[model samples]
Target: MKKNTEKTVNIWDRLRQSDGQSAVPTDQPWPKIWQGAEGLGQDFEPDVEAGLKRLKAKIHAMPVAGARIRRLTPLARWTRTLAAAVVAGLLGWGIYLLVQPATPVATWAEITTQAGEQKAVVLPDGSKIALNSASSLTYRTDMNEAAERQVQLIGEAYFEVERRPAQPFKITTRQAEVEVLGTSFNVRARAEETTTEVEVTQGKVAVHHLIRDEKVVLAAKEAVLVANDQPLVQETSPHLNRQAWRTGRITFRETPLEAALPLLEHYYNVTITWQKSAAPACSITGNWQNDSLTEVLQAIAAYTGITVKQLTADTYQLSGICK
Candidate 1:
């Protein structure tokens, strides 16, 4: 029975130590200061009640006036409770604001095609771009923004830009800057070529030379050739065969023999050279179906009287005097 009584006393002592009372008075001006906080004291209801009970028990158990033991009263304990509530409220509000998702922003997409591969992409602005083999184009989907209507192209691409007079569409490339109000144009800037070429199909396009600060305006069915280093513009005879590349077709209408070799090399991915001591100049006009490079070469050989022989996988020698 004695041991049971001692155990009960030990448990109560532990509880008192764990929930100790404050050392300040309750009726001081500090309590009124807490009330002056505009209901900040109201936020401490749970803590104030718990602390008040602890203070009451402590004051009842405290020794007489001559003793050194300190006691806790209401107002001082309430001040501490209010401070804790304010900190917790701010922390809670901060956590709530942090967990919300951020608003999405406009973005751009880049389209590219490898060698021997082509792709057609429709942009968010309803403009269509037919990327040729070994070409790349970058455009923004949110072109509705004033600054987002521009596109950058590398290698070669055929653009059918959507018409927007207020928001003009611009295509920046290595050789020329092609800007259009609304039009279709083809840009080719191959590494081997000494000049960048632009062919306009429909509507009008303004071509700007980056180095020269000069501009050339081309109407429908017109074209311009720009040299790599020279900042000069020259009009060129428009070749319908050039536009054929967009459809992957190699069409030559009365093209010179030298000029035709490069077109065949680009399309068929084969080297075609003359075997004779002096290569004869010929104006070749023919249309071969976009099929195997061998068949196309064979068709050209059969009609043009040039013997076609394959030296390696990619090397083809065209030998025969023009008939």
Candidate 2:
């Protein structure tokens, strides 16, 4: 054994002195390490494979880089916490995007008609409203909801309310409130007019004053006029002409010229002024369906034995000038 060790030492010394010029056999290097390992095994156990497995286990169980571990500073800890919070927030937002149907935005609708112009709108509940000249209707998009089928009206509108017992429709005007389950009626609450009128052509309606709280229930062919602070007064005249303007017709059954002229002006959105205070007293009785302004004026002149002349685009004058 001593002789073998001397021979190995001399070989290594030669290799070092020659700077690897004298090449050593590749297989000869591990023999020296193996000899050292074999000497260590003799002190432990006879089974090399079992001892090696135990050593590997011990190495794996030892703490890895224990001295390199460092505690976070206050600022660093906060940064870590904020990063976790940001991740959690992103996760929550992603979950929110997965469920629940998106809600559509609620919108308000408004319709305004100028003079000589009219408009018709079908409400969300399938109810119909015909707005007359110089009229406005305001409503919301989500109107079909219970107690939400409400509309605000100004000027004149003919309403054909749909029958919804659960959702009673209500019309609010500046002068009064008209509530109905189902009704076809005409509401005239013009700002210039002295009285607010409600005439039911079909069905029934409950009309109440806004500021006064006085309520009146009117059925088909019934009409009421609500004046400020006064009790509700039923109109003595017939309600047949209540829906005349809707059909582009003016029906006068023994209606006086002074009163009929206003209806004609309202229907055609025109103005008529007389020069004399003592004008010809004549009553008009006819049905002018969808007639032009000039045609209506000529027909009126023929019926009243007066002359009609256009003063302007929207104005007409009456006199005995035409033969």
Q: Which stretches of candidate 2 lie over 4 Å from their true place?
A: 1-107, 278-280, 321-323
- Give lDDT: candidate 1, residue 301: 72
Give the per-residue lDDT of model 1 (tens digit) for 127-146: 88888878778876778775
lDDT of 2 by residue, 217-277 (tens): 8988889988877788886454656677797767777777788777777777789976444
Best by TM-score: 2
lDDT of 1 at 262: 82
All models, RMSD in angstroms: 21.2, 13.2
- Per-candidate TM-scores read 0.61, 0.63
Point to the candidate with the largest lDDT: 2
Query: Which parts of model 1 have CA positions greater than 4 angstroms off?
Result: 1-108, 231-237, 276-278
lDDT of each: 0.76, 0.80
**Which residue pairs show collisions in model 2?**
none
